[model samples]
Target chain A: MQGGVIALVAEAAGAEALGAARGLDGNAFVVTDLQIAYLALGRIGPVVTSARVLGTGPDGRAGAVVELRDAGAGDRLMTVVNVSGVPAAVLAGSTR
Target chain B: MTSDHPVDRRTHVSDYFRLERWELPSDGGDERPSSFGGRAPIDDHQRGAGGGLRTGGLLTNLDTLGGFTSGLAALPRWIVTTSLLATVSELDHVGPLRFRADVVRRGRSSVVTALDVVDEGAADRHVAAATMTCAILDPRAMVLDFARPFSLAMPPPQADPVRPEEFFCIEPGAGPVTRLRLADQLRNPWGILHGGAVAMLADEAACRAAAAHGADASGPNGLAAADAVLHYLRPVKVGPVEARCQVLGTRAGRTSVRVAIHDVGAEDRMVTLGSVTVLAV
Candidate 1:
C-alpha cells in the first residue's frame, strides 16, 4: 500500500515540477517512468515526497528525481526515485 | 574460460532472452565515450497476464545490456551491479523492442548507466526507462579480453529455453520463503548467480508472501507483480540461494513487500535486498 501511495505522490510531484519547468499545466502531464531505491523502512505514518525537475525533453517529456520521507518519523529518509512525466496525449494509441 | 570458473561451457541467462547486439557509433561524434544497444523480439513465454513482458524478464534483459555498457566504460577493470531500477510506461508493446544504454558517469570506483527501451514496431515510442549502478573492481585472477566496439550474437537456439521459473526450478520452502539451487546454467560470465535469477527469486518470494498475506483475497484473479526495485549488495558465490519475504501492507488491491536474499551455503550472508509491489488482477 505504501509503495503504491509513494508512486502516486512521486508522479504528482514530478508532474508539478515538470509543469512548472515547461510553463504548462501540470494536469497535462502523466507519469511515464519511475525507478525507486529503498533506503530505509518507514515505520511511521504520513509519508511525504519532494521532487526536482532534472530536464525537459524536446518533445515535452520531463524527468525528475524524487525523495520520500516519513513525516511522523523525524523526517527520516525512506526512498529515492527517478521519475518521468510526459504529455498525456502520447498515450492516445498505447496498448497499455 | 578459467579452469576454476567454467562459465563458457554453460548457457547463460542472456541466451534465453535472444538479444541481438549492434555496433554503436561514438556519442556526439566523440571517440572517447560511446553508447551500445541491441534489439529483441518479444516471445510468448515472456508475456505476463497483462499481455506484456514480465517485469522480471524485462529487468533481466536490462541487466545484461546495461552491465555490458558499464563494463566497457570501465575497461581494465570489471563491475558488479549494485542496484537496478526501472519503470515501464507502455506494457502492451509491439514486436522487436530496441534497447539502448550509455554511460552516465564513470568514476574510479563506480559506473552508472542510463538505459532506455523503445518499441521499434511502434515508431520508437518509449516503453521503459532504467538505470544501473555498478561497483568498479579489479578482475584479480579473472581475464579481461574483448574486441573493441564489442559485439555478440544470440547463441544458437536450444530446443526453446524454458521460462525462468522452469529453468531455475524454484520451489517453495516454507511460509513466505522460496529456494533455488545454484546450477551451472544459472551462472553469469563471472561464475556467480545471474542477476536475473536473483530478480526472479525475489519476485516469486514477494508474490507468494503477498498472496499469503491476503493480496490474493480478491478472488481467483490472484495477484500480479507491478514493479520491482532490487539492490544487489553482494554476489552469491555459493549454492541453495534463499529468498525470504514479508508483506509490509495492502490497500486498494495493492500490496507492498520486502525481500532479503541470502546465500545459504555462504554462512547465510544477505546477498541482495528487494522491494516489490503487486496488484490484484
Candidate 2:
C-alpha cells in the first residue's frame, strides 16, 4: 500500500512541484520508505489519501508523508511516509 | 559394505532402547542395522554413531498462542509442523502466503487449517502462527494435488553470510557492515525499485544482521528472523543504504533486535524501522 502511495505521491508531487520535478507519466513514483501509523480501520468506499510532499533531492530520491482517511467521514485512518526517486528524464510535469 | 543406513554402539543403545522403549522399531527386523552397509562391518560403526545421536528427543508441543509465537521464533519450529502437516494433509495459498487447509473436525477429513503471516511484529508482539489440522488419512483417501511448494533457504548465520545485503553501509569508518547496491536489477517493470525489493531488502538485512549479532569466528551460527512485517515508508532510489541492526537481547535461544535502514544524507531519515526476533536453530 505504501509503495503504491509512493508511486502516486512521487508522481503527483513531481507533477505538482515546481522546477525539475514531476513524473514523466504522472505514475512513476519510486518509493524508498513507508512509515504508517494506524488510526482507524477504513471500511468504506474510495479511501481518501492526502500526501504532504517532504522534498526532492539532487540524488534522484524524494520523500513525503500521506494521511489516509474515510472519504465520507473524513476520519483519519492511516498515515504513510513515502519516499521516491525522480529521474531527470521525466522531470517536467510540474507547473505549480 | 556401502549403505545409507548406519549403525553403532549409540545405535546399539537406540537399538536396545527400541527393543525396550517402543514396540515400533522403524526397522521390521529383530535387530536394527548397526552400521552403514550392514555386513557386521567396522567402518559403518563410526558413521552410524551420528545416526544414534539423531534419535534423541522430540520437540514439545506449544499450547498457547504466545508460546506458539515464541516457539516460531526458532526456524526449526515449522519444520516439524509443516512436515507433519504435509505428510497427512493439503494446503492452499490465497495471497503471497496466507494459507488455508482443512482442520480436523468430527468425521471424514476432519481437519482444517489457515495461516496468515504479518511481517511486521504484532503490537501484541507475536511474530506469526501456523495452524495445522490433524486427522487420520484413510487408505481410501483421495489425494488432492494441492499447492505449490513453499521452500526457502534458512536464514544464514551472524558471521559470513550468503545472502545479498541490499541496504548499504556508507559510513566512512564505522567498522564492518553489509553493502547492497540498487543499480540495474532493483528496478521494477516501471524502472524503479519494486515493492518486493523492500522485503528482499528486509530479509537480507535482518538475517545477516542476526548472524553478525549472534555468530562467532567459527561461523556455524544460526540467527534468522523470527518475525518481520515490513512497511515501505519510502522507496529506495538508485543509492545505497547503511543497514543498522541494534541488538536488543537474546533469551532462551531467541535474539530480539531493532533495525533501521538509513540513507547517508542530510535528512538522514530512517526509511524502515523493524522489531525482529531471531533464535538459534
Candidate 3:
C-alpha cells in the first residue's frame, strides 16, 4: 500500500472518532500530528479501523488514537495517534 | 605468457555494488516519459498537473535503491527493513540523480545503512538522504509457510492496462480520504506488499493534505517534502486500504501533516502511521 493511502485511511479513522466525541456541526478541523506503528501483516482481506479520543485541547481541538486490524481473523495491523484542532463553533456545540 | 596489460587486483570493492544513473532531462523535456513505447505518460496522473516528480515516487526509488545497495553487504543473509527516515531539500525538475549507499554499522543480527541521492551536477548538494535499519536473517534458518491464510480471490483485471506506474496512485474517497488497492506487482518477493510502497502512500497523503490547506500557495514551485518518518506496524495483505490525513499546523511556509493507513474492511484497525513536513516552493 502507498504511504499516502495509508495516511488517509488512518486520518479517516481519527476524523470519525473526533466527530463522534464532539459534534462538529460545521466547524473545520486541522491535523497537528499523526503517528503510526505497525504490528502485523494483513494477508487475508479488507482491514477495519476504529478510533478513540485521547484528549481535548483548550481551543476545542482534540487528540485521537486509531487502530487498524484484519477484518477476517481480527488481527491488529497498525495504530495511529492523531492530534487535530476543531473550530470554536464546534466546541461550543459540544458543550451544549 | 603474460600480455602487456597488467591486472591490478587490489580487490575493487566498488565493483561489488550495482551502479545506476539518471540523466538530467533537457529544458522543457519530459521528466518521466512513457516507457511503453508511445503509450500514455506513466507519471501524468501523479504529477497533479504540475509536471514535477511526486515526492512519493522519489521516496520509493530511494528505498528500493537503498535496499539493493544494502543487499550487497548482507551477502548470504536477507535484510529486512525495520525503519526508515528520509529528508528532502528540493524535488523540482532537478535530475541527473545519483545515489551511493554506505554501511554505517554492521552487527551480528542487524546493519544500519545510509543512502544519499544527489544531483550529478552539484555533487556536494543532496537532494534527499535516507537511513534504513535492516535485520540480517540467516537464509538457511528462514521458515516458509506457503500455506498461510491468504485470500484466494483476485482483483478484477484492468480494462485497459498499460505499463505499470512506479509509484502507487491515489483515488479520492469520502472527504479528505484516499484509497489504494494492493496488487501482486507491488508485493515483495515474500508475497507481501513492499515497504517502499507503503512509504509512497504515506508521503502522497501527507503532501495532498498539506496542499489542501493552501500549503502550495507559495508561487508555482509546488510543495517539497522536507522530511518524513515511517513506522511499519504490520504487513498489508488486503485490498482497498484507505488513508486519511490532517494538517497539524503551518509556519514559515512549512506545513506538517499526520497520516494513518487502515484496512477498509476493518474500519477500526490501523496499518501504518506517518509524519511528514512539506515546504512551500
For every model in order, the fraction of real contacts preserved is 0.07, 0.00, 0.00
Q: Report, for candidate 3, the interface RMSD.
A: 12.9
- The digit string of per-residue lDDT tens for model 2 on B206-256 reads 556666665322324343343333333554555565556776655433355
Count clashes in each candidate, considering only residues at least 3 apart in sequence or on different chains.
Answer: 0, 38, 48
DockQ (C-alpha based) per candidate is 0.09, 0.01, 0.02
Candidate 1 local lDDT, A1-96, one digit each (tens): 267777777778888877877777888777755786555567885888887665554556567667778889888766667776677665445421
**DockQ for candidate 3, C-alpha atoms:** 0.02
**Candidate 2 residue lDDT tens string, A1-96:** 344553454345433332234434434443322333333445653566565443443334344434456675556343332323344343344211
- Alpha-carbon error at B272 in model 2, in Å? 1.3
lDDT of each: 0.74, 0.32, 0.53
Winning model by lDDT: 1
Give Cα distance to truth, residue B200, candidate 1, Å. 1.5
- At residue A42, candidate 2 shows an lDDT of 54
What C-alpha RMSD does candidate 2 show over the true interface residues after superposing them? 20.9
Q: Is the docking of candidate 1 incorrect, acceptable, medium or high quality?
A: incorrect
Q: What is the TM-score of chain B alone in each candidate?
A: 0.88, 0.37, 0.68
Candidate 2 CAPRI assessment class: incorrect
Ranking by lDDT: 1, 3, 2
